[model samples]
Target: MWRDPGAPADSFYEVRPECTDVPKSRFRIKAGKTLSARKWHAAFSPEGYLDIGKTLSRIHRGGIHPSIRGEVWEFLLGCYDPKSTFEEREEIRQQRRLKYAALKEECRHLFPLVGSGKFITAPVITEDGIPILDPLVLLETNTDNGVVVPPQDNNAGSTMAPSSTGANLEKVTDKRTIQWMLTLHQIGLDVNRTDRTLVFYEKKENLSKLWDILAVYARIDTDVGYGQGGSLTE
Candidate 1:
């Protein structure tokens, strides 16, 4: 992580240099006011029905505490319905995890960097959906990872991965998959630049996590694919 002398660490919670000129008493010194973990838990019923209105009031009042921020964001993002019961939300999470894993499994062979602790900002496929294997061209400014296009038959250039039959990898002829491949380099680019101001992105694994996220999104929403500056979806 990079040093920010004005603050302890460069992170979402850390105040940037530009924000340092504000009144500390109204901002920096008011950290204790954020919603605490205990209060956050109390907003949920035993059966897991969330007090959406009350929770929103508290959140908008002081923001959420970092300890439970991830869980809170899940609700905010509509990952689970506010009216859903505990058992229902648990089942939703399990199904979502399985679907995501399946999506990643489908994409892993299309590009080597899918789950690899590295990403590439270079073009790995052409407009016509052809694989590009030039190492020099695939290398990014501060990253390293090779592209892996699934194997295809000598006669037919199909991109099917035998998801149902469980056979060897095959070339992808599907337009959706090809579109997903085209967005890989862009995902790497935005991912690398996502939190560059903060030191958290210095770790390749962290960048890879972002890469996997965007890649999975691209795979899921092939119609929209991926776009530049899309990593700000917090």
Candidate 2:
């Protein structure tokens, strides 16, 4: 006769690692006195190399101080190299900001719906090849009750015309550009659904920021494409 641990003797059983070595401290900073900037600098090496594991252990034990958590997160997230000095990190930050700005400018140039100051709007091509105004835009601009009034010049207008510089924006429907736009659109949809209960997510500007970051990532990592589920959840 076979021995049974608890359930019926014939029942099947499987075992898996419990991950006992992993830290179990709540992943949250403490309430009152948060980690200080000075303490943060001391946690890393003079060479700018951060002992992330050790630092995380400390955070797990004591929790981060609320005040310095934001700045500390930048270091934790690898936004700045742990081995870099304050001055070096600042320089890196400025360079990254400029790079991200340039990417946003490029995105705006390619997609008119982007950077249009209307966060909820998207480009919709009608049967006549003319773009229709987004319903959200209509909601804001139209005083009428849920009635959408089409623009006067439904036919191809100056907005749809080729640029004065002779750049045939409409004709340039390259494969890569189309893919990027599709990825961006999917990212926008994901952002809207992400953390919907959070007050910050309620603002369109915050959602726009999420979309921009995801779009830039998609542009850089063409192989990965746009991911759903857990990719946007965090």
Candidate 3:
């Protein structure tokens, strides 16, 4: 014959953190006092059925005895391998690869991020330390020292002769090319140890020395000429 311990009183069960998802039964002894027989009857009917929420309330209120720590950890970790499907893992891997591909595509534009330009300096440093002339024109005559000419100032005289204007324009163009070459060289040097190509070197020293030898070849081979600010893309 079943007997009631008395009126229903609030109770709790002991739940380990490892098995937070599955709580222990409320009928277990708790706090030196077992759950009242009537309370257990309402919590669990005959035929061994259990009410999870009612058990959860008992567990929350510390009404049940605690389980072994190791067993709780094993259950929480899913050591039982309930999801025995490899499909989920494969899907996760595919998603990760897709994410990586997207990132690579986004950053693909930055090619020569740290390498210098490929052209060597075309210079004949005068004993006084000034470049004599444009390096490309003098390549055939002498590779050791390029012609030295003072860079002309267009601002010195606004209404200069045609010859002067032509010279000025040539000088401006040379200066621009040289400046670009130097910038590439510096960036290439910075990324040297990283195994990136600074600039392609000629197999045999060409008589025609200029900054854009490899650059020209790259343009021809790849069919992509230099674009403004594209150097930074490197």
Candidate 4:
């Protein structure tokens, strides 16, 4: 696996940066508390302006400053909701994993990436004065892993693993486990939210793909039938 600084590391918290001299009245720290239009503009000289594409080009070529990478990601995701504080953002984050198992199974193609510690997003700051960023940090972490932990809600004492019939690597269709599958699926979608809706794919199209994957898995691995609206409900 590629060594990346962004891989999972020891869990600890650090204090975020303080607001500079930007006018507190007009420019407020928003969700993620890492970015604001006023704050961003302030990062440059008062006379300078930023073009998003050009700025990204610079960062991509020159690399993002280590201190500001989190802010840059937040800005790119438009995750800085003005109404949500860091604590609120965290609560929302916790609620995102109510359906993890289903999501992992839904996007099962990416499973190998997770098990290989390839999806990690933390930097492994080097001992050298100049540090490099790496994304492979753990065998189990990914972009969604930060906000969503494994499902904790107990439902009827059933374990999460698919049944033997459904365990086939090529397919998963255990009917008795539809409830568990659907629950995990919902959690997956919730944790992947962005301020820009459907940023990566068309909303309807993505949902359709999810439906096809889950429906097929269910039919082949379980006795479950796809009742009307069942796919959407998932």
lDDT of 3 at 216: 35
Reference-based lDDT, residue 209, model 2: 72
The positional error of residue 12 in candidate 1, measured at the CA in angstroms, is 7.2
Single out the weakest 10-residue window by summed lDDT for candidate 4: 7-16
Per-residue lDDT of 1-234 in model 4, one digit per residue for the tens?
Answer: 953333211112222234233222222222323233444444543333334554455555444443455666654676544334556666655665444444544434222222221222232122221112232322123333332112234233222222222111122233344343343333334323321222333353454345444434443444554443354343
Which sections of candidate 1 miss by over 4 Å?
Answer: 1-33, 138-147, 150-173
Judging by TM-score, tell me the better candidate of 3 and 4. 4
Model 2, span 147-174: residue lDDT tens: 2232334333322221222122232234
lDDT per prediction? 0.66, 0.53, 0.33, 0.36
TM-score, cand. 1: 0.73
The per-residue C-alpha lDDT of model 3 at residue 115 equals 18
Sort by lDDT, top down from the best: 1, 2, 4, 3
Where does candidate 3 stray beyond 4 Å?
1-178, 184-202, 206-211, 216-234
TM-scores, all models, native as reference: 0.73, 0.58, 0.17, 0.23
In candidate 1, how many Å is residue 210 off? 1.2
Model 1 agreement with the true structure over 1-234: per-residue lDDT tens digits: 953223211244444444445333222212434566888789889999999888888777677766688999999989889899999999988998898888887767555567667677887667776656465443431223222444545335534221222234344566766777778788777887774544555677888888888888888886777888888773
How many clashes show up per model?
Answer: 5, 6, 24, 19
lDDT accuracy of residue 93 in candidate 2? 85
Where is the poorest 10-residue window by lDDT in model 3? Answer: 107-116
| Candidate 2: clashing pairs of residues | 34-65, 34-66, 35-65, 48-82, 48-83, 49-83
